[model samples]
Target: MQAVNISGFRPITTSVPRSAPYPSSARWRLPMKSSSDYGSCDFSCRQPLRISSSFSAAAAYTSADGETTLIQSSVGISDLLIVGPGVLGRIIADLWKKDYPGSQVAGQTLTTDHHDDLRQLGIHPISSGSNVEKFPNVIFCAPPSRSADYIADIRSAAACWSGEGSFLFTSSSAIYDCGENRPCDEDSPAIPLGRSRRTDVLLNAEGAVLEAGGCVLRLAGLYKFDRGAHTYWLSKGSDENRPDHLVNLIHYEDAASLSVAILKKNLRSRIFMGCDNHPLSRQEIMDYVNKSRKFDKTFDKFTGTDGPLGKKLDNSKTREEIGWEPKYKSFPFFLGVNTD
Candidate 1:
């Protein structure tokens, strides 16, 4: 086997016996035989059939014919590369470290501005021009803001992925064209390309990931304690606020957990929705914020009644598939309101 350059990252080459007639791609679920199995039993590939070097210590069995079969014992989050380790990416990295101690977590940033901060959190930072290593588990959390061509960026990230692991792209739920406050799901129709520039870029990028057999997570509005839509609304004071327009939201922690779940599952070419399953209007959100008195500032009253309504996202199927439940169930719940 020879080293292959994918985008700018080069996969470390390991020689495999040419006499073995293995298929181009295959996956196997092998039983663990030792304590060093990384707590996972699944292994898969997408490129030319070859086991990952990480599995060098995998178990092997010899048949009567003297043929030896190597079984990959585990495929866990041992080595991870997070593209654009911003707020969400950093959270994911923290959780990864907590769950899998001693695992290496590297983050890629566009500049050296926050490299020190990443280092403080025990994350190795890869600057823009630095050589990227091919990671078995990769999660792309970079927004499309700075990219001249977001689709191309996604392609480059996809290329840097090792075929033996999972690659996930964090996309936005804004791609869905369900603006009339209609209920939306993973199967909802996306805003057609060319109609909206933002959606077009995201949709194209998502297409690139799916074509490469990666998973796509369309996340709803992400909010934390101090930063989010409510914070922005309170700061800027929108005069044209549409009080009736619904908005779907998810806490940052929940979103990070969902990302981790999807990566661990290693699903391919699948789209998953992430939301709190609680759709609240602008007025409703503000009402809860005011009632809680958690913030020093409060949002002004929203007077406007007519505008384009956001989608009501129902991720019941996603919850069932991923076996995840949000810690902060809704905005009101987070604000200590008994919505039940």
Candidate 2:
């Protein structure tokens, strides 16, 4: 596997289980979906209708327009740990609570307030001491492209998993070299570029976690609440980067939902790419932005920074293997960009 980098709150909800028409990220934590019990299963092992109130392979879906929506079933972390309590980490922590009130998510950050935030979310804070004694199912929601030594940060966290339960490290799609105009699938080559050590840290981090019997999920570029790709363009008001740079994005909700799914399924030791299937061009997106937002989303052919971002990320692994199909296939609900 090559290395790429990628980059919640919890709220208490109903404890009652119900059966209804399955919308993609609908059921929270119902009960464990038993394949034999369900009597029928989807390609990815998802429980058929009336499967159970429990878990969703829930589906990790990527849209053609670049949206990542994860519909997961019920599962809780007896003790959940979220390392890197930054913006991304916070987002995950919030969503985790909404999906699985039963699970305990603890976020780790050098920041002092992170401890308080974790406490608020009912998550244990890992500021200094280790949870090795506790062995919480951990989720390292960190970006692979950030700090030069970011990989080391994750390694330090993995030191805690006692080779039990689930431990996931969030990675990126940048591991595949996107030269000009090419979309890379999970099976694509690890064509490295920029600061990514496709052969080193990115892969190393994934290997370390997996060696400990944990799972690795390679994520594509993400956008939500006016952040990341869409935000960048909104702020720029111009079409610069390859609008069609194979936009594979997951909504904030999908990421958290997928985590819930993994815990429910008790999965381990596999590589899954996180993204909506549809890849769009920057020009096409910018045009949409201008047409919809009534803002100047136009730009010259080239502007801002140009680094090696991967293209056309395949999220079929998530679907075929875990029965993941994201909701909000594109940033529509939030973007005012509709696709009917």
Candidate 3:
């Protein structure tokens, strides 16, 4: 077979074999195989037909101006294991299972606090000694709470990995808290988390993943579905007295979707900043929520400038590279606020 670009539906110049009796415009279906077996998997195509949801790889070629549509479709891994699967991790695992039914999903938690809850969600609890070979796709979602031991924890988990597929680590955008009141992207410089030591630990863990050819996603403040800090404050009627500091956020669902998108696209060894397109201020979000939800939250008559204005995030690289866009563009969309 001829080499084809499967990432996007771009036109390609290739000839079919003489033995194959098919027109140029015919749709050709290919079975899933390893990246070594096939030329390369296209991780950018959307709206693809569900050929075989099996963990084994599969691809489909639609004949239209020689466009090749090759979606990795679950990375061909039969199982996935999430380390320290908190809220975001659970969301990713659930979305992954929903998108690819054939894959087995499990989670590893240090404490038993969420074991029963995870089991109810159909995610089996796994330990460090669990066969990493069986679950080649591993995601590290542990936060910096244990900053002192984060590096060792990730390294230990990574050491157990069989190196069959991609490993993704969830990092926080606080790493970029350079105190700059401007917009930043993945290439921007970040201030050292001096004295705090938490940022250093997180950075160390990210470095380890990068060294291992894994992926690191720096996420913004997560909200929606009764889990936003802003929402908590709003419910308490506390938004009226706060300053309008800039804030970036990604809806829980969008974050989950993006994680699964990265995996299906076979992305690795890169840092992706996960945030929605809009960056609203505290007062703006509060006002919108109050007006839309009729919360009747009280605000202070005086606006106090206590801290530096927050930074905005640019997500153009993620959108262009992954061919994925957040279903919720901004907080307004999440809150169902009327744009008109």
Candidate 4:
């Protein structure tokens, strides 16, 4: 299997440009552990970009003059049309609507034959469920390995689409043919799967999207709502090494926000990473969860298979180019640190 967690070290901050990105400090707080548990972060978020008050409204793409104009010019929300209403898809759509209330955003999903939900959410679902004909920039979060066929369909009929926007097909880091101990990053080079249908299909689909002018996002396991994988595993048992395995989970907030950020950056024909910067083994996580457990339920140490076929992914590109940093940047808080 691929390496179990993201390794190597890089300071998580950027050099301040004399002028500020926000009017004051970019007041965003990292998840706080109990004074007894997590005293502070182990990694360095030190770039002197620290500010106060507004984390969500801060800009990483600003200039020396400290103006929002430059940031908008470099990166701004783009019109987005997402495919599939899987957990990931729904979260991305919700974030887009919340962040860019004025932008045109619609989702193409497998119809549930009901208009009430879509109507209430103000989302347009192309329930016709026919092949995707056209879109400004299409994002496919479909899980099946054969989902690539849909991208091929769109490519085959490229003439139908305006051909100026982008297409971001969500793929997993599992394409690397990994094991349990070794870890991998974006530039680590993917191990050829020969004919691994799911990984292979993603490759073909990526080629088609790039050929037609778009980008690919090789993502890590995504967590959100109450359905988070880390949260599920953490709430399990405390067998010491119970949470000892390295974890690479991406918060749904970051995944969805990154999709919007990529489009805003106007990138084409490239790939980027989307995993949390903090690396915590499964053992440590489960302990934290059990200690913080609320409802008083008996916990069991979970062990079956090693883990998913994939491991960690590099996330630097998403931050440098797209100005997209995860809301939940650490693991314990990435899942356990719910804003709610």
Count the clashes in each prediction: 0, 52, 6, 15
Q: RMSD for all candidates, in order, please.
A: 13.2, 15.5, 15.3, 17.7
Q: Which segments of model 3 are wrong by more than 4 Å?
A: 1-76, 128-134, 146-148, 177-180, 193-195, 239-242, 294-303
**What would the per-residue lDDT of candidate 3 be over residues 1-340, giving only the tens digit for each residue?**
2222223221111222222121111011222222222121121112223233255453443322233333233433546777878888889888878876766676776655576788787776654333222345678887867434666566655553435666778888777754545887766655443334565566666655654546778888999856786667666665444366778899888888887787666554567788996888877777677657645564333256575777888877876777789999988887788856
Candidate 1 per-residue C-alpha lDDT over 1-340 given as tens digits, one digit per residue, 9 for 90 to 100: 1111233211111222222111111111122112111121111112322443343344443333333333333333367778899999999999988877766687776666787798789887765444334567888999989976566566666666764567889999997778788888866667665576676667667656665667788999999989898998877655476798898999999999999988888776677889999999888888788888888887778777676878899988788888999999999999897665
TM-score per candidate? 0.78, 0.66, 0.72, 0.64
Candidate maximizing TM-score? 1
Which wins on TM-score, candidate 1 or candidate 4?
Answer: 1
Worst 10 residues of 2 by lDDT: 20-29
| lDDT head-to-head 1 vs 3, winner | 1
Between candidates 2 and 4, the lDDT winner: 2
lDDT per residue as tens, model 4, 89-184: 777777777776654455544444533465456555543223222344567677654343454333432222233455666767665544563666
Q: Where is model 4 poorest over a 10-residue stretch in terms of lDDT?
A: 38-47
lDDT of 2 by residue, 88-112 (tens): 6676777767766555555555545
Give the range where candidate 3 is weakest over 10 consecutive residues by summed lDDT: 20-29
TM-score of 4: 0.64
lDDT value, residue 26 of candidate 4? 10
